[model samples]
Target: MFRLAALFLALSPATAFACGQPVCLVDPDSLSLTKIITFEGERAGAGPGHNIDDVLPLQGATFGEHFAGQSVGARGPHDEVSGDAFAPLTMMAGRAGQNLSLVHFSGNTVLNGYGSAGFPKRDAQGEGAIAVLFDQDQSALAFDLRGGEDGAALVHFYRRDGSFIGPVPVQPTGEFAVAFLRSDGHADIAGFVLTNTDPQGLALDSLRFGKPPDMS
Candidate 1:
């Protein structure tokens, strides 16, 4: 039960990713993100499983902030098991008697449906983006994301073992932010301010456990 704010960012390369911002760049010396993956949870042999789509957005774009004004039908937390892009089908076998199957659709509806959440209230749209970073023999990832307009933002963290660690803190900037964590346990976090003066504004925000660049 880790708690991060609604504006923090996340990085997950174990699965394919898409972003709404152009700031996320791959270091090239790391792995590559190939395809976008979708996951559905299993219930008592009925009911639809939780669905989650990953979105990476370019900087300076305002998305999903409108959803903040109202409750949405497609809002919820997702377990990595039910519909995670990085986990393989074989991992589902660990669960008791329940059988999990992967459904290959032409594309993910949840990830692509952010546009319909209503605007001002604008639909959340994004392009696929992936970047990789490494720490010696181990690997880590970085990404830029944008939830649909009004859609609250969140940052989730997990260890290399596929276990949940927690969420990070997010600034109350009213826009999205990107987070980068190195395998060595250091992070550099920042976000583009959602304003008119410097439409493409950027700030050298804070880190969880290490020194970050001066924001002044």
Candidate 2:
């Protein structure tokens, strides 16, 4: 009788042991923490030639030290605005100490499009590089990039502990493009450094933060 029972259990369907399974399948796309916003909801201004910088706090993100009392339309040479010249930027819904800063390069922190009245012009300033730092750990980040006339722009992401994540290349184009990055199963995206070969440098707009909509 014992031998007969053992043979019956061994021949049972695999579903009989489903409760003892050690692994469960998970969808990777469901685990993603990033999303891209093309700013389609917001107006792109009258036309490509018209640039607007007065718009702020769009989609919960702020530019430069504007929230910290910096005036809008402020322009300075790369040397003057680089480093700790401006206070770190913060998001409206971000944590108390969570902030973002621009380092080692100068250009308008807020510009709607490529060619505004006071937009920086292409110069012989050599290759320009900017470091964007986030004070708190984030799983995703994105921004609109434009005005690269010389060569492609490269962005390198880093972990919260300052470890390298990877590099993304942005081709020089006449129109604005979106560059988005996210960590895989890790919320360690601390910051990124962008270097551009364009003589006119690069302009960033419509900065986005937070997780993807589906993840919410």
Best candidate, lDDT: 2
TM-score of each prediction = 0.25, 0.43
Q: Provide the lowest-lDDT 10-residue window in model 2.
A: 91-100
Per-candidate clashes, comma-separated: 30, 0
Give the range of the ten consecutive residues with the poorest summed lDDT in model 1. 88-97
lDDT of 1 by residue, 111-134 (tens): 212122221111221211111111
Alpha-carbon runs more than 4 Å astray in model 2: 1-127, 212-216
The TM-score measured for candidate 2 stands at 0.43
Off by over 4 Å in 1: 1-73, 76-152, 173-177, 182-216
**Cα lDDT of model 2 by residue, 143-176, tens digit:** 6565556456666555544445666666653345
Per-model root-mean-square deviation over C-alphas: 17.0, 14.9
Question: In candidate 1, residue 20 scores what lDDT?
Answer: 25
